[model samples]
Target: MAEAFKFELVSPERLLVSEEVAQVVVPGSEGQFTMLKGHAPFMTTMRPGVIEVTGQSGTVSRIFVRGGFADASPAGLTVLAEMAVPVQDLKAEQIAREIKNAEEDVADAGSDETKRVAQEKLDQLREVQAALGAPAAH
Candidate 1:
């Protein structure tokens, strides 16, 4: 069998992925980076984007993350995501609904800071939708 490195993906709900893979590409807040076996130890804040993985068996998977952080060490790569889902299962309609709700929250916000924070959340959601190639939410 081919040598593989451990990869773990964690979301608030549960451990989403735990496997031995050949490679992983994480969307760091600074930029996207790929990790292979024996990668240098490092850490980076994550952005709303895709996490690409190449399994030991050569199958590829794409997982979308809202945001969080990624760490790479001699043991392997670990991703702690705020929210994550397999790209194939993501639904545009659901994201569109979230955008609408966030808009409502912004309008109902009482304080200036609250309004700004709500708007920022809405913007991040929109960015994720766009990155997934979904049309702008109506």
Candidate 2:
């Protein structure tokens, strides 16, 4: 039987998930990474993307996380996402609206730093939209 490890997914608003999972895939700032039972202890910054968790119950779930931190240890993994939502809960229209707002912000930002920040937000929004099965924005 495959080994299982404790996995917790948390957001500012609430604890999204807490269970024994066979494996989990996280989107690290450097790149995508996976965690399984007995993984070496480490901590890394996370990026905006989908987190995939395969639970002991044989169910797979996905969460859209917008930046945070992930801590992995031999005993378990903990994810502290700045914001997270179940894939099913994502709305295409909402994402599209956010993208539009970000684009407007990018256009109106006065300082270079502000523009850069807006661009990053737009990129993250696009990533979420893509993960939600929406076609890429032109």
Candidate 3:
């Protein structure tokens, strides 16, 4: 059996999860990485993606995060997210709506820089939608 470590998931609104976990997969800006007990200490900014958490009992929970930061230390792993929601709680309609809104933001951008940023956001939203198996926005 894998050793368990403390894990916490925090959003701006509230603490989402705090418990012992066997493993956690984080979506870092550079790439995805997994955390386990006795992991080397490090911190990395996250991208828009899903975080997969494995509990001591082997149950897996997935949380979708818009953006965030993750830290792995001797103490444990902590994720501070800009926005986080349980994958089970997310609906297809909600993802579609977000994608539509992101597309509109891209279209409404007035400057080249603004357009690029908006496009990046739109791309990320589409990726999330695909990951969730949500229908494409109308």
**lDDT agreement with native, every candidate:** 0.88, 0.87, 0.91
Return the lDDT, model 3, position 103: 84
Instruction: Tell me the TM-score of each prediction against the true structure.
Output: 0.79, 0.82, 0.88
In model 3, state the lDDT of residue 106.
88
Question: How well is each residue in 1-138 modelled by candidate 3, as lDDT tens digits?
Answer: 689999999999999999999999998988899999999999999988899999999999999988889999999999999889999999888778777877898899999999997887778888989988888887
lDDT digits (tens) for residues 32-135 of candidate 2: 99898999999999877899998887788988887899999877999999889887887777667768888999999999999998898788779778767876
Q: Name the lDDT value of residue 71 in candidate 2.
A: 99
- Which model scores highest in TM-score? 3
Off by over 4 Å in 1: 1-3, 98-127
Which candidate, 1 or 2, would have the higher TM-score against the true structure? 2
Ranking by lDDT: 3, 1, 2
What is the clash count of model 1?
A: 0
